[model samples]
Target: MECGIFHTPYMRPGRTDKETFEYSMMLAKAADSFGYRDFMVGEHGMQAWENIPNPELLIVAAAQVTERMRFAPMAHIVPLHNPSSLAVQVGYTSQLLQDRYFLGVGAGSWENEAVLRGQPGDLSEAHPRLLEGLEVMDKVWRRQPFTHEGQFYKAAWLEAGIEAGSVDHHDAFDLKDGEEYHALADHSPYGGADGLEIAITGLSAGSPSHVLAGQRGWTPVSFYGGSTLLRSQWDVYSAAVEARGDVPDGSRFKVARDVFVAKTDEEAKEQAKNGALGHAWSKYLMPVYKKYRILQGFIDDADVKVDINDVDLDYLADHVWLCGSPETVMAKIERTFEQTGFRYGQIAVNTHDALDDPAPWVESLRLFATEVVANIEVAGSKSPVHEFA
Candidate 1:
């Protein structure tokens, strides 16, 4: 599969926001230069670990520096903003990037974020609100005069026009009527005469959002879950798409995984255990996974019966993470594909803090992009391997 980078970027403690953003830019530049397909960043309003509140700003900046890498908000929480406003902003972003942007939407998952945004901490209405918001955004992007009276939002778009010489309108160029002047007449996506490419993140097994993605024919992005969870998600999504008389394509599916590569397997394991990846897991991700009881997926995927408490860095290195030498990592990737029967188009590398020592992190990304990727035969497989057959 083609490679990509997914930056949730759990920055180390005491890092300034500027430093964090610059670090992300560094990774973006590296990924672009390394020939990655896309770069995605998570959007979070309150969490310091996942600190980017507006991923669009980063995407815009990265677009300037990168040549061909596409960008997306690993997801923009749909329940937090006015759908029309977000639609317009995303449309503009897509226009600025010129085919380098895709939209990823989700309901706010964190209760604290929901509470901070003046909603119930339980987020009871978040899913329903997300559904309505997505519908409103779709309508808004159609560029038709329409009104929406939904459960969580009320919005309308009225068509407005400007005549060539009406109401003392100043034509800066003073061009003839037949001359083409590129104006923001349509706020739809750039080259979105068809439709904007939308993706949805699915974390938990059998997530309904993934089902929605299948029904809408949007990309289904699976978080760094183990093979079992990935298979479950694909099964759910494929079933949904099949029910709707659509064939599920694996190329539209993205799978995120924590990856680290070194000269040797032992070195990679040690670095992953003691370096930024380890720090992120020990300090940030593990805690959240424990709180949300997300560690069971790993536990279930392991060969031996392991308690959630025992799911440490070593356990992860052996079972969940794709950390090793290039050869080992490639084998792991191929194994995952063989097990799941789905060759994902994009292998989104789950990135962590590289502030402490950027060399190893950068090197790992380089090896994965250059060596491992070059060695893989199924890098561009668009369909499920033997699944449909």
Candidate 2:
């Protein structure tokens, strides 16, 4: 139960970016004061709730203000990035942050990033495109040259370079109409440099992508938005890993989800029930999350609609989120462990309009970490784990 802070800098109707930045800074500074172990930020280009549209820049700002916190993206849309270039920037950031770097990458949702800029949001055609992009990035960081020829993308006779204390964007682009769209290189070390871990949020362990990676011995950062929903998903994934004849030593799976913790059972429910987060539910995730729920083993069909109003704060507060007073929050968290068997309870505590109230959010983080985390035992494991046993 390693409690941490997750921020989604939302632009509430009345606030300016400067005001928002000021408030977000307050939250980060508070996380520092409160002695939190990690602070993660997210990236989304179009949503109002997604203010830190570029989490890497935000990470630098957070690192400058805080003394120590393992910083990462809840995940980045890796497929959209030039992997070689991503490697350099992340490597520099990781070194600058002095090894407190934990990089989380995802193929991502919302193909609309390119769509909004007069392009297409078709990951159906882009994932394989970006997958090869990552290959070039992997080799380039190790001072190697690699060529690529894959559907939707290609690179030939290329190399990239890195320098001490700076990110020099080397041979790192496949330009179309004078705009660099992807990477062309011989070798890429996007996740290998600095011992960075590669993680994937998937449909399940038995899903071809997850199982394929597992078969080749890549430990994935397995994610589930809710615990109960993923219990069966984890079972399937872990079983696939074990059955693959190449399961990694220890459980190399991480269950990362959004969680909120509070002091009193009553307060916890109120904190999470409806205002900011439920607003978020209404705005973004609920509309799209249902399909994944079914794909992840929760429901048979994907008619996903969550009436935010219908969500019982108390039931969800106690059951899903690690929320309650110190005594109660701790108890629920322990129960979460017993039930989920997940070592990593990655808590994305921040939500819609939440960062706007910097002071209280920070205080809640401190209360959860000091009061609840101190009383609990960290389920011991290094690999991202899916199930409890």
Candidate 3:
């Protein structure tokens, strides 16, 4: 039961983008000091409400402040860019981090992002495009010349300049051919590695990406989903892994949940219920669900008679959020594992603008690490909790 943090950099009423950026980095540094396993930042292109156009840049800055925490761009919206370009960027960043970076790729999901890019604001085409983009990246990173033909993208005899003495003069420079002949691989950012860790996210339960994860041994992550949906995703992932003659393990499965913690259960609930967590669902998420007519996708029970139009903050808090004192929060996570069969799973705490004042937010994060994580780790050993100064 490892813990990680994912920040969405949610914009609130009065907080400037600068303030949000600083606050997010502050929390990430705290996670570093607390010995969390990893820190991940998400990328969004057009949505002003949740803005952080290039999470990779932020991860680079964070790497300077943290000593051991691994960083990832939670999911670079794959359909928006050329895979070849993204692959080089990712490869360069991985080498810069000295292999401390992981890649998470997904189809662009937010409606504004898709429409801004002149594509239908739907998931239908994005999935195949995402697959093609990843395939191109794979071919490009193999350190050789390659070609790809796909419905969404294609490459014709592009060379990586990785093979010894295979450098092309055109790839060397834009200057008149008199310029010094140099290979891109001669100055390759990744010293010699072929690739880095790869992960895929499923926008929907049991998506084709889950099968890809199983086939490729890539980690699978689901964002802010209920246990029922997560279990369905794991079922699909496990079946695919078995089909490929590999054993599936929960160690690599990650589930992100909206979490807040406090010194006491009552205080925690009061803060979450009255602060940004409450407002985020009521004002932003649920409204979007209703507008898109996809509220059913988020609800825990499909048979229940409920109106998506009438869904409110309380319903979301009870079903989706993991909020309480350390003990209560740990219990909820344990139950999530039991229900979803994520026995060796990692818990990614999804952070947003939970409060206007950053004090409670910082305190809540500290408590989660010092108390909830300490207790959960010891419970497995049937040993006494480690004393902290």
Specify the highest-TM-score model's number.
1
lDDT of 2 by residue, 1-389 (tens): 44455565545655666666666667777766665555667666766556666787878887888776667775666666766567677667766675666666656666677666444666564456446666665655665556766654454434433322244655444435765333443223334553665545454434444554455444454445545544554555566667876443323554444455565667666766654554555556554555455322322211343443344434345444455677876665555555566644344355446654444445566776566555555544321111111
lDDT, candidate 3, 1-389, per-residue tens: 56777776566646666776787778888777766666888888667667788888888888999887788888898888788788778887888897678888888678778777777877577877787887787666665667677887877544533443446652433435655433445222354434567777775667677788898888887774556667778889999999989988877877677788888877888788788777777667667655544456556442344566666666555555678888888887787767776664566777778545777877877777678866664223211113222
Query: CA shift at 339, candidate 1, in angstroms?
Result: 3.0
Instruction: Give the residue spans of candidate 2 off by over 4 A.
Output: 9-16, 117-122, 156-194, 202-223, 232-254, 282-285, 294-309, 312-315, 341-348, 381-389
For model 1, residues 1-389, the per-residue Cα lDDT tens digits are: 57888887677767788998899889998887777887888998788788899999999998998887889997999999888899889998989988789888888689998888788998898999899998898888887778788778998876654445554667544667766643445678887725678889987888888899999888888885667778888999999999999988877778888899999999999999999889899888887777765677767766776888878789888777889999999988887787778877778888888786999999999888887865666544432212211
Candidate 3 residues lying further than 4 Å off, grouped into runs, are 13-16, 156-182, 186-195, 289-311, 377-389
Q: In terms of TM-score, which candidate is stronger, 1 or 3?
A: 1
Task: Return the TM-score for each candidate structure.
Answer: 0.89, 0.72, 0.84
TM-score of 3: 0.84
Q: How many residue pairs collide in each prediction? A: 1, 25, 0
Q: Model 2's lDDT to the true fold?
A: 0.55
lDDT of 1 at 8: 75
How close to the true structure is residue 100 of candidate 1, measured as C-alpha lDDT?
A: 83
Find the number of clashing residue pairs for candidate 1.
Answer: 1
> What lDDT is obtained when candidate 1 is compared to the true structure?
0.82
